[model samples]
Target chain A: MKKLLKYDYQYLKRTSKFIIFPVVIIILAVLSPLTARYLNEILAFSLGDQAGMFNFPDPVVFDSYVEYLSNLSDIYLYVIIFIGVGTFINDKTKGLYPLILSKPINRVKYLLSKYMTLSSLIFVSLMVGMLVFSFYTYYIFGEVDLLNVFLLSLLYFIYVELILAIAMFSAMYFKSYITAVMITFAGYILVSLINVFSFEFLKYMPGMISSNIIQVISNSASTPDVIYNVVVTLVITGLLVVLSITKFKKYDLN
Target chain B: MDAIKTVNLSKSYNNTLVLKQLNLNVKKGEVYGFIGKNGAGKTTTINLILSLILKDSGQVFINEEEIKFSDLAFKKLIGYVPDVPVFPSYMCAKDYLRFTLDIFDLGDSMVNQKTEEILEFVSLPNSTKKISSYSRGMKQRLAIAQALIHDPEIIIMDEPTSALDPIGRNDVMNIIYKLRGSKTIFYSTHILDDVERVCDRIGLLDDGNLIVQDTVDNIQKNFFSNKFYIETKNEPKFVLKKIAKINQVQNAVKENHGIVCYLEENTDENTLLKKLMEMDENIVEFRRVKTSLEDVFIRLTNEKTT
Candidate 1:
């Protein structure tokens, strides 16, 4: 396990471009909630006295949390997928994977190290972005419940893990980075398209399933449906991880 | 016991045979030269020994233990340098060494000492540049340094000097010569001169078979020709005609001021020299001609082709 860690650290240090893309996505994530608040304020000011006649509610902490969840689900998830796809594909094209395999390490450890590194990075970046947004919302709209914010952050981590599993599965299946990225993106699109059948069935699709759960957690929907979506997403993510590990063992590193 | 041995090893790719019933044995502390032309399956044989590819039949034994892909004991006993070294390109030399050490779980105290020693040995000391910035010669040197860091019992190199300039080739050959006694080396190359300079024994591969395997002296002796050259003080035409008329002499040709006489099998060189001496008292130099390795290689290959 220590050897695996050393190998993963070497890979992460050498491939800074892979890490830089995710950092850019995290920056966009931090800016998203603030941008939404500014746009809401601009519309209220432009309406002038008509805003009072319409009985409009001012932007609150809940609104900012909603914006954060939507941004992460739609945009940040794709960034995670793209980053995960490149992790294995780059090693294959450069002939570094076979060299690593020639060492004392086995196939399971190799794949597990990659999984742990990408997942850990994603978790850290998400936490940092959420911390920044939490501070921004507090300064702008006054104090909010800390417990609710922590629960929301935990839910976001689980959601990211699920999406990352799908991306890694794509990586293990394809030999080229471009092919892996395209297939993962297409899978996301296919899930989204299937969700358009009806609101109830759409909530069950893996891509939108997390967003629906987040919406229910923000006190916008029923609790029973939220629990069901969360359980189903977790189950699917577990199965995909097992499948990816098995496929990686059988793969020819040459 | 032999350091390495292969038994009836066979492999095929998409129904095309790459190796067919190949067998080889390399004794301990011997520099075995694997010689063949391009696409002669030298790299494929090395890959099989390293367990990078599966074999369709037979087995490879290293240090008397059967090679298993999952068991890394044999891997620790061997160091391999490919024809073209591939690195991450983003790493500096020091970091690359550290990473490799960490993978093998070497002690921290010895890592720096070993790294520095090998770097100096390969003449790449003070090389702190990233791999991407390294020249071809520099990269090849670094590859050698990495392969030797573990102090494996055997080093397998494929075309180590094929792409180098003359100076670079000499530098690499010098390093190999210096390390001869400390470790056994098995290198494959088409350059016969390099083999003659450094190898103690050689194996010639043709059509996926090891056609010849022996020491340099033994091979030369086995392919020896029964032709003798005689230098005479008299005109060479008279001696050539007289030698051709002898019953034991099959053919005689004029060569400069001498005449070369080809004798039948079982004809003694001493007897022929006595007969030539009796015929011509003006004979100056008389000795049997020796065959070179090039002749042996050509003869073996031609025999296989026909």
Candidate 2:
């Protein structure tokens, strides 16, 4: 398992995954705060004559957090879904499984290695993104809640985990990159749709993770509800991982 | 003990049986050529033996130990090279071999030395070109290199040279020849000529059934041993026609430069020779023909189909 981890790390490094991922997240981090800070002026400049017609409210540190969190849930999550599906399915599609599986490696560890490696990359990239967002937020807005940003990043990272889990499950189930990506997107949309339901149980679904992340940034969340959502998401992620491994074990690498 | 054994193994796809109850045994320290045509379940059998696919019925054994689908220990005893071996494109040959070593938990201090030594065995250059940039032949050499890195007791290859040029094929065949006595090689291929050159024993599979299994010499000797080639001064066509008239000649046909005759069972060669002299045909050369592996494969497969 440790050797597999080393190979996965080497894979990430040689494949430029080590650079592309963090660079993308850091770009989002820098752009989020910059966009949140200057949107009003930029928009006003665009509407020069009509600039006075609309009063633009001042952007706050909360808006920067909101921008960053929104980017994480939208763009960053899509990146995760696409890359995650590719990583999971490419081994099978590209004919890499027969060689790798022919070795004396456990199926469970083979799978977890990829998941853990990619998840670690995502975690580190999120942490780096948080630091960048906080620095920019402090420089521009003069106030940055480090703990809230940290918590928000951590919450968003958990959501990233769920997305990756769904991606892995979809890749294993569908075995086609496009189909896996489409299925993961469908799963994302289905979870979000469940979030709109009025049922009490629906509040703890994985979809509520995005809202919980926001509540953390704005300091308006119920601690118990947040805990419940995290627990339920973790449980679902675990189940999906189990399902992926089971399917892969039975899969014919012909 | 057999290095690899399959008993009553069967597989189906979409309700169509691709592999029937196949009983195959590959003995240790021998080159077993698994000869089959396309879609003859050769790869399927390999997959089942390696636990790469689920078998609908029966069991596989390696070194006398029954194998399960999830068995990893058995894998340590065997190495596999697929029909089309693929590697992580981002890695060079040394990197990929090192990764394979890591997979087997053989990441010792001699990893670099072992990698270089195996690479040299396959005749792969020691350059650091990424595997993605390699040609098909180069990838195949690298595949063999990686498979031998751990010095496994058994090596299973599926059509390793089916897609290579003559030179590449010869290179792979030479490597197999070099490893012949030291390792058990379960080589799967439709290339009968290579099998004739390298394999000690063979199992011919037709429609998933083990139709024939024996040593190369025994199979050839047992199959159509009475076939004789007669070259005469007369036209081959006329010779064939006259030969067909002989009672001892059960069948006669004109070949490229001679008349080939299949003598009836218990027919003496002297009887046929005397009758040929009676026809007043000047015989230039007359000798028993050695049946080739190709001839045996084609005739057997055709007979099975008919």
Best by lDDT: 2
Stretches of candidate 2 exceeding 4 Å from the true structure:
B233-235, B247-250, B255-257, B265-268, B277-284
Among all windows of ten consecutive residues in candidate 2 chain A, which has the lowest summed lDDT? A192-201
Give per-model CA RMSD: 4.4, 1.6
DockQ leader: 2
Write candidate 1's Cα lDDT for B98-154 as tens digits.
777776667489888888888888888556688889877777787777778878898
Residue B103, candidate 1: alpha-carbon lDDT: 69
- Candidate 2 clashing pairs, residues 3+ apart or interchain: none
Second chain TM-score per prediction?
0.86, 0.96
Model 1: how far is B273 from its true place, Å? 7.1
Q: Count the backbone clashes (under 3 Å) in each candidate.
A: 0, 0
Q: Tell me how each candidate scores on DockQ against the true complex.
A: 0.43, 0.84
Q: How do the predictions measure up, each by TM-score?
A: 0.85, 0.97
